[model samples]
Target chain A: MSLNVGVIGAGAMGTAISQCIAPNTNKLLLYARRKEICDDINEGHINCEYHPSVKLHKNIMAVNDLCDLKDVDVIFLCIPSSVMRQTMVQLNDIVSDKCIFVSTAKGIENKTNKRMSEVIEEETGRSAVVLSGPNIASEMMKNLPSATTIASIKKKDLEIVKNVLSTPKLKVNTNHDVIGTEFCGIIKNILAISQGICKGMGINDNAKFAVFTKSYNETKCIIEKLGGNRSTVDDYCGFGDIITASTLNVSRNHTLGIWYGQGVYLDEQTGVLFEGKNTTIVLKEICDKLNIECLTVNFVYDVIILKKSPKKAFYALWEKL
Target chain B: MSLNVGVIGAGAMGTAISQCIAPNTNKLLLYARRKEICDDINEGHINCEYHPSVKLHKNIMAVNDLCDLKDVDVIFLCIPSSVMRQTMVQLNDIVSDKCIFVSTAKGIENKTNKRMSEVIEEETGRSAVVLSGPNIASEMMKNLPSATTIASIKKKDLEIVKNVLSTPKLKVNTNHDVIGTEFCGIIKNILAISQGICKGMGINDNAKFAVFTKSYNETKCIIEKLGGNRSTVDDYCGFGDIITASTLNVSRNHTLGIWYGQGVYLDEQTGVLFEGKNTTIVLKEICDKLNIECLTVNFVYDVIILKKSPKKAFYALWEKL
Candidate 1:
C-alpha cells in the first residue's frame, strides 16, 4: 500500500515533512536544491542545516536531480511560493502524468492573486492537493504529536495523501474544500501580523482578542466569497493555524509585524522576506475589488505598508469596533 | 441624558465595571456586602481591596443596603452565580419595576441547569440583559482598551445598555441572542480547562491547537442545539473569551486544569472556588441528557472529573482527531 513520494526543497518544512511521511512511503525522495544538503541528508542520515539533532528516516533518500522524482506517485511542492509556478513548470516535464502534486506553500501570486494550487494546476494541467494546519516544522522534526488538514477536489487524492501523512505521531484530516484549505494558510499570515501589531503597540489582551475574533470571522467571509465552504474555517487549517501563527512568537511574519508596530521599519536589505507583507497588499486589493471591507486587513495595511502610526491605526480600528 | 446605574457586589469585576460606566451615569451605586469596603469606596474613592491603585470615579457611591438601588434605572448583578437567584429575589422587592437588570455572572445553576439570565428571570420576572466577553477586570479597571458583547431580548434594553457601557476605550457590540451570549460564558470554562490540561501534559502546539479548533466548533454546535445562533459563537462573547481564558494564565480554571494534569489533585480545602470545575460537571450532565457527543467535553470530564490520566484522555481525544 506504500507509494513513492518526493518532497521538493530542503528547507525546514520540506525536511520535516519528509521525516513525517517517510515511514508510510516505500521510498521518500527528498529533492534538495543544494548539493551539500542532499549529500548530508543521504550520507549522514541527517538534515544538518535545518534539523541537526534528529536523524532522517531510512526510507527517505535525498536526491539532487529532478529526474529522480519521475517514478514518484506524489510530489510535495515545499518550495517557496515565489518559485512555485516555475518549479511546477519544470516538475511537470519530468514527473509522470498520473503523479499527484501537493502544495505546502502558503502564498498567492503577486499580480494574478492566484493561490499555489492554481499555479500548480496551470503548470501541471491537474488539480493539486493542499496540506496545511498548525504545524511547526521544528516540532514535527522532533516527532511530537501533531495534526493537519489535507484537501483536494478528488476524493481519491485526498485518501492517498491522508494515508501518507497520518501516523501515530502525526494525524491528518481530509476534506474536499481545496480553496478553503489553501486560503486558510494564506489568511493566517495576515492574522499573525495583525496580532503582532497589536502586541507591539502594547494593546490590552481584551482588545487584541476582540480584534482576533473579528479577523477570524472575516477569514470565513472571504473564504466563502471565494467559493469555499464557510465552515471550513472552523477546521484545523483555519482556526488551528491562525491561532498558532497569531499567538505564538515563532512566525517570522509575526516578528516583522512587531517591529513595524514598534515603529522600527525593517527594509528589504535585511534579506528576510515576509510573505505576509505581500499578502496584506494582495488581500487589500482583493477586498477592494470584491467591495468587502475587512478591518484586520486594512489595519495591517495601514501600519505595515502605508507606515501609518501604529497607535493611530489601532485607535481607528478600535473606534470601528 | 445620564441614567442612574447600580452595580451589585464590590468584587473585582463589580468595581471595575462600575469604574467603566461611572462616566455615563448620573449616580452609580456600587453595592458592597462588606461594610468596610463600602465605606472605603465612598470615603476614599477606591475599592481598596480589589483595586488599590486605580481611583474609583467620584460619580460612583458605594451602598451597604439593597434599598439604595430602588431608584436606579439599571442594575448590574455582579455577584457569584451561587448567590445570583437569592440576590435577585431580594432586589426584586427593592428595585423599581421599570429598572433593567444586567447579569455579568458566567455560571449555570448546578441543580437546575439554568443560566444566570434564566435565574434572574425566575427571581425577578424580567428579561435580564446578558453581558460577556474577554474582559479582564484589572485592565478594564485602568480603562485600558476593551470590548464586550451585550445581548437582550428587547432592542431598547440593548440600546440603553450599549450607550451606558460604550466609552472611547471600551467598545460594545449589541445583539439579540441572549441564550447564545449566556451560553458562551458558560461554555468557555470547558475550553480553558481542556487547553490548560494539554499545556500541563506538555502536548505539542500542533496537537493542542488542533483540539482547540475542534472544541471551538463543538461550542458552536452545542450552542446551536441549545437554541442559540451558531454565528454568535464568533462574536466577542465566544471566540474572544474562549481564547482569553484558554491561552492566558489569568483564569483559575486553567490553573486548576494544569494542576490536575500534573497529577496534583487539590482538595476543596485549597478551594479558591474554580467555576470551571463545576461547569465541567454540569456540562457533562447537560451533554449526556442532550445526547451530544462532544470530544472536548468528554476529554475535560475524563481528566478533571473522573480523575483519568491526562495523557490517556488526551490520546483518546487525539485519536478521534
Candidate 2:
C-alpha cells in the first residue's frame, strides 16, 4: 500500500529520515515544537544546528499540531529522549490507528529501562518498532549510504517499516528481534564512553583494543543473556554500528573520548549528547538485578558521570573481566 | 625459565619481534638470508622494510646461519607464507629440542588453507605457538600500545609463547583458539576492502554500518564453522585486531578498500602483504570444503580478484542477503 509518512521531531534525525523516504511526491508531514521552528524549517530546508550542509524536500512541511498528521500511514518518533514522553502524551489521542508506530530516538527512560519503542507502544497503546544503527545525521542528509535495522514483533509491521524507510541511499533491514536491536543501540554508547575513558588511561593501544573487544562482548552477552537474539550482534544495528559510534567523531559518546584525550570538559558546543547517559543508570540497575556483569557500563558510569579516575574504575572493571 | 629468543628473517616483522624481546637481557639471535644483511644489522639497528623508526637492541646479534639458533629457547618464524614451507623444511632439524615456536606471519598458505603456525609446525616438525593480533610493525617500532594472541594446543607451549611476547606496550593474551585468531587477521582485510567498497558506494552512514555488521557476522561464521573458537570473535586476537585492521589506514586491506574506492589497485605499499588479495581465494576454497557461508569474503573475491565490476558483485551479494 502507498504510505503517508509523518516525522514527529524536526531535528537532525527527523530531517535524515525524511530525506531517506519519499519527499515531494509522496504524502508526507513533519511535526515540530513551535511555529517559529516550523517557519525556520520552511524557510530553509536544512536544520541549522545539526545538518547545515544538506537541503530538504520541497513537499515536506512542518506542522505545529499532531492532528495535522492524522492521515499519515506511519509515524516516526524522532524526538530526544527527554521530550519523548511529553510528545507521546500529546499525540496519543490524535494519532491514527492505521499508522505504524516507530521510534528513531536512542535513549532509555532512566526512570524505567524502557526503550524508546517500548515507551511509544505503551503510550500509544499500539505495537511499536525501533530504528537503530550507526548513523550520522549530517551524512544521511547528504544521501550517503547508510543502513539500519527496523525491529518489531510482527513481520507485517517490519515490512511496513521497510516500505516506508527504504530509499536509493538509505537501506533498511528488518528483524523480528526488536529487543536485541534496541538494546544494542542504547548500550553501545555506554561502551563507547567506557572506551573513551580507557583511551584516557595510560594503557597502550593493545590494552585499548583488548578493552574494546572485551567490553563489546560483555555488552553482547548482557543483551543475548536477556533472551535477545545472538545474531543481532552480527548486524549493523549491533557490532558495526557500535564500532562507528565508539570510534568516530560522529557520536557524542565518542566525542567524549576525544574531549577526554584533549582534556576538555563536556559542554554545549560539543553538540554531542551522551545518548546513553540516561540509560547508564538503567543498565547498572539491570545488571544489579540480573547479577550479570554490566562491567563496561558500570565503568562508564563511575569514570565519566561520577568523575572517577579511569585508573580506579578501569582496575575495578579489569578485575571482573 | 630464562628464555633465549631466536628470530628468523631480518625484515620488518622479524626485526621488530627481536627488538621487542632483546631488552629483556636475553641472548637474541637474528637469522639473516645474506651475509651482508647480517653484517648490516649487526653494525646498525635498522630494519629497512618494516620498522625503520626504532633503534635495534644491543643484545641482538645477526647471524646468517640457522644452526646458530639451535641453542635458542624459542624460535619465531617470520618468513612470508610463500617461502615458509621451504624455510620450515630447513629448520626442521636445526631448531633446539625444547624450543617452542611462534610465528609472526599472517596468511593461509595460498594453495593449501594452512595457517602460518601450521606451516611452521609441519616444516619444523614441531607446532610453534601462533602470535596473532593486529600488531603493526611500524607501531611496534614506536613501542605503541598493541596486543597480540599467543596460542598453542599445548598449555605449556602457550605459556612459553606468552611470557616471551608480553611486554608493557604489547600485552599477549593466551587462548586455545589459534585457528579463530588466524582467520580474523586474514579475513578482516578482505572485509576492510568491502568496507571501503561500501564507503565508495557513498551510501548513508547507517547503510554502510549495516553492511559492516553483515560482513562481520559472516566472517565470524566462516571462522567458527571452520572449527575455531567463537569467543575469539570478541577477543583481542580476533575482533579487536580486526577493528584495528579494518578501520584504520594501518591495514593493507583497509588501504586496498580506499584504493578500490578510488579505483586504484592495492599493492606492496599497503604496509603488509594484503592477505585479502590471496586469502579470499583460500577462504573461498575453505568455505567450499567446509560448507559454510562466506558471503562477504567471497563477494570481495569476485570483485577484486575475479575482475568483476564492484557494482555487479555488490548487487549480487545484496540480493542474497
Candidate 3:
C-alpha cells in the first residue's frame, strides 16, 4: 500500500521530497508558505528557487495553507529552521495529532533555543522524526541516490518514518539518538566556517585537510561529551553529513566557509540564510556554560558574524591551539 | 636542531616522508631491501613507485643496508602491518637502542594481533610514536599544508615527537591515547571496504551516506569496548583519518572498495598488496572472536575473503541487522 506524504514548505527541500516520494506513492502534497510559491510550483511544475529539474506529479497537490497537509501520513517539515518553531505553532492547530512528522531542515531555533524536532514536540505535544544528511536538493532531484538518518527518541515513530521514506533512490536509516544527529548537523557549520577561515589565511591544501580532519574529530568530541551516543556521530548523519557539508560546495554553510576562505565576510558570503550562523551563536554560549574547548568555532563565529577580519580571528584561534 | 630522520621500507610512505622532512633537515635516509629502488631514488632523485612529482634531496641517502640508518635520531617503520611482526624482529636486531621511532604503516598486526606501535615496542625494546591522521604521503611532498597526530602513551615522548615533526607545511598535533588513534585507523579501513561493498550494491547516495555515518559510530563502539579513549578517535587520528580514508581516492583501501563496488573480485580489484584487503582478514577474525556486532565489516569480509557472493553476504547481513 502506498503511504500518504505531506511536505510543509514548498521550498527546495519540500519540492525535492515531493519529487522523491511521488514516483512511489499517490498521495503527495506540498504546502507552501506564500501564495506565489504554491501557485508557482502548481503552475510551472517545478520549484524555481530550489529544484528546477523536479517535475511535479499529476497526483501531487500544491497548496498555500497548512490545512492542506491534514491527511498526510508523514509530514516533512522542510522550511527554514528559524521559522520552524512558529510554523509548528500553527501546525499544532491544523495537523492531526497522530501524523508521523519529519524535519528536513537542520537548525536550532535561535530565540527559543530549540532543535526542529524539539520545537515540533513542544508546539504539537508530539515527537516527530527528523530526516537529515548530506542532502543537496539539486542532486537528489536528478534521481541521484541520497541517504540520511531518521532519528527519534521514539522507536515506533522512527520505524514508521523509516518504512515510509526508505525507498531505492533515497534511504532513511533509523537512529534513536536525535541529539547526536541534530548536533552534528548544526555543529558541522561552525567547523566548515573555521576551515574556510584557514584556507583564507593562505593555508595550503594539506593544512586544509588537516583542519578538516581535526574539525570532524573536534565536533565528534563535543557531541560525545554532551551525553550523545558516540555512534550517532560516527556514521551517516554525523560523519557523512558533516564531511559532505564541509568539503563540498553543495552546502550553504560550506560555501560560506569557502567564501570566508576567500576573505569574504560571513554576511556577504551567504547573501541568504544559513542556520549554522545562529547555531554558532548558541554554540558559543553553550560552550561557555559547558566549559568546552571552542576557540576554533569561536574564531570563525566572530569573523563571520561580528564582521572581524578572518586573519585576526584565525590568529586568535590558532594561538590558543 | 631537528633530529636526523631515517624512514625504513623505501616504499610509497617512506620516500614521501623522507622528501617532506628533507626540505627542512639534512638528516634524511631511506632504507629498502632492494638495491635498485634505493639506487634509483638516490641516483635519479625520483620515487618512481610512490610519488613521482617530488624529488629526493641530495642529503637523503637511500640505503639497502640497515647499518646506514644507525646514526639517525628517529627511524620510521613504513612496512605493511601484516608483515611487520616478522620484519620487526629483523629491525629490532639492526636498529640501535634508545633511538626514537615512529610508524606510518596502519593496520593491526595479523599474528600478534596488535596495533603498529605495539608491534614496534614488542619487537624492539625502544618505545614508538604514531604519525597518523590524513597524512597522504604524495600530497604532503607537494608542499600542501598538512597536519597529523604524534601520539604515545608517554607524554614526554609525545611532546618530543610532536615538536621535532612540526614544520611549516607539515604540522603535528598531539594525542596521548594511541590505542584510540590506531584502532580508529585500522577499523576505518574495514569500514571503507564495507562502503565499497555498499557502492557495489547500487545503494542510493542517501543509503551510502547513512551507512557511512553509522559505520563510524560502530567503529567508535568497538574502540570504546577495546578500552581506547574517545578523545583519541575524537581528534585527528580517529575521526579525521576515517573521513579522509573513506572519502579520498588516495587511500588504496577506499579504492579497493570502489573496485568492489564496480563488480571486481577483491583480489582482482586490489591487485594484491592492499592494506585494506589484509585489514578485512584481520578485522573479521577479531570481531568474530570478540563477538563484536560488526555486521557491515564482517559481511564485506565474508564476501571478499570467504568467497561468498555479494548478494548472499547482503542477505545474511540484513537478516542479522
Candidate 4:
C-alpha cells in the first residue's frame, strides 16, 4: 500500500529515520521544532547537525507546523525522551486518529520511567510500535546496511511496519515483546559504560568480554523479573546494540565510560546527554523498587552514585564474580 | 594443595598458558618440542615468540622432552587442534595415569571432529577439564585482566583448577557443560570471520549486530540439538569470546573475513591457518550429517565452499533473517 509518512525531530536519529522512509513512501513529512532545520531540509536536503555529507531524498518535505503532517498515515516519533510528552500532546491536538505511531526514541521518561512507546500510546490514544537496534545514524546516512527490531503487540501493525521500513540497507525484524525489547535498548547503554570503565582500568578484552556476557545475563534476569521475555535481550536491540555501542568509540555512552574509567565523573552538569549515566540512576531505582539484586547494576551504582574509584569498583566486581 | 604443573606446546598460546600457571604453582614445567624455545625460557627468562617483554617466574622450568613432565600432578594441554591427537599419544606414552589434564586448546580436532577434552580423555584414560575464553595470548602475556571458563565433569577437579589457575589478573568461572563450552569456543571464530566480512563490505554496525545476534541464536540451537546446554553458548567462552574476537581487528579470523569481503580468498595455500575458515567447513559437515539446518552456517558454507560472492551471500542472509 502507498503510505504517507511523517517524522518528528530534526536531530541525527530523526534525519536518518526520514532518509530510511523517504525512498519508499509516497510522500515524506519531517516536522522539526526548529524552523531553521525545517528550512534547511526543505531547501538544501541536508541536516548538518546529524549528517553533513549525505543528500536526502527530494520527496522528503520538511514542515514546521504539526498541522502540516495531519494527513500522514504513520508518524515516526524521533524526538528526545525529555520532550516526547510535549511533542505527542502537540501532535494529538492536530493529527488524525488513524495514524500509526512508531517510535525511534531509545529511552525511558524521566519522571514516569515509562518507555517511549508507552508515552506515545498514552498521549496519542493510538496503538504504537517501537523500533530500536544498533543503528548509528551517521552510518545510516551513508546507506550502510544495519538491522533493527520493530515491536508492537498488534500483528497487523508489525506487518505494516515491516512493509514500510524494510530496505536492502535497513533490515527490520518484528517482535511482540515490546517491554523486553525496549528495556534491552535502554540497559545496554549502562553496560557499555561499564565496559568503558573496564577499558579505562586497562583490563584486556578478556575482562571486557566477561563483563559483556555477565551484563547480558544480569540484564536478562532484571527484564525477566519485570515480566519481560528473557530471550529478547539476546536480540538485535539488546545484544547487538550493546556490542555496537560498546565497541565503537563514537558512541556517547562509550565515551562517558572512557571518562568514567579515567576517574572523571560526568553528569548532566557537563551538558552532555550521556544516556547510560541517567539510565544507571533509573535502573537502580527500579531494581530497588522491585526488590531484585542485580550485582552488575549494584556495582555500577556504587561507582556512579557512591563515588567508588573505578579500580576499586573493578576489583570488587571481580571478587564478586 | 601444592600442585606441580606441566604445559605442552611452546607457541604463543602455550607460552601464555604457562605464564598464567607458573606464578601460582609449586613448580611449573614447560614441555616445548623446540629446544631453542625451551632454552630461551629457561636460560634467558623470556618466551621470545609469545611474550618477549615479561620475565617468567624462576620456579618455571622448561624442558624439551615430554618425559620430563611425567612426574607432574597436572598437565595443561596447550597444543593446537591439528596436532592434538599426536601430542596426546606422545604424552600418554610417558605421563602417569593419575595426572589431571586441563586443556587450554580451543578447537575441534580436524579429521576426527572431536573436541580436545574428548581426545584427552581417550588418550590419557582420565577425566579431563577444558578452559576457554576471550583470552588473547598477547593480552594474557601482558598480565592484563581477562576472564576464562573452566569446565569439568568432576566438581573437585574444577576447584583444584580454580586454585591452580585463578590469579589476580585473570578470572575463571566454572561450568559442567564441557561439550557446549568447547563448541562455543570453536564456533566463535567463524562468527568473527563473518563480522570481518561485514567490515570489509563497509556494512554498518546495525547489520553486523543483527548478523551477530542471529549467529549466536543459530549456534545455541545447534548446540542444544547436539545434547549440550543451550545456556552454555551465552556464557563467557561463547558470547564473551565472540564479542572480543569479532569486534577487534587483531583477530586472525576477522582478518580473513576482511580479505574475503575484499574478494581476496585466504586458504592454507596462502600460508595462513585461519581456524574460522576450517571451522565453517567442519560445522557445515556436522550440521549436514546430523540433519540439522542452520541458516547462518549454511550461508557461511555457501560463501566459503560454493564460491558464492560475499555480497550476494550477505544479501541472501538478510533475506532469510
Which candidate's DockQ is highest? 1
lDDT agreement with native, every candidate: 0.92, 0.75, 0.73, 0.83
Docking class of 1: high
Return the DockQ of model 3. 0.42
Candidate that would win on lDDT = 1
What lDDT tens digits, residue by residue, belong to model 3 across residues A213-276?
Answer: 6566567667877767766766567777776766555666666766766776644454676766
Off by over 4 Å in 1: none
True contacts kept of each: 0.88, 0.70, 0.65, 0.79
Candidate 1 chain B: 10-residue stretch with minimal lDDT: B263-272
Candidate numbers sorted by DockQ from highest down:
1, 4, 2, 3
Quickly count the clashes in candidate 3.
16
Which digits, one per residue and each the tens of the lDDT, describe model 3 over residues B31-142? 8889888878878887777776677777688888887777777777788777777777876776667677887778887666788888878778666888777777767677
Residue B170 CA displacement from its true place in model 4, Å = 2.2
As a whole number from 0 to 100, the lDDT of residue B226 in candidate 2 is: 74
TM-score of 1: 0.98
Per-residue lDDT over B169-241 for candidate 1, one digit per residue giving the tens place of the 0 to 100 score: 8888889999999999999999999999998888889888989999998999999999999989999999999
Candidate 2 CAPRI grade: medium
Positional deviation of residue B132's Cα in model 3 after best superposition, in angstroms: 2.5
For A4-51, candidate 1 gives per-residue lDDT tens digits of: 999999899999999999999999999999999999988999999999
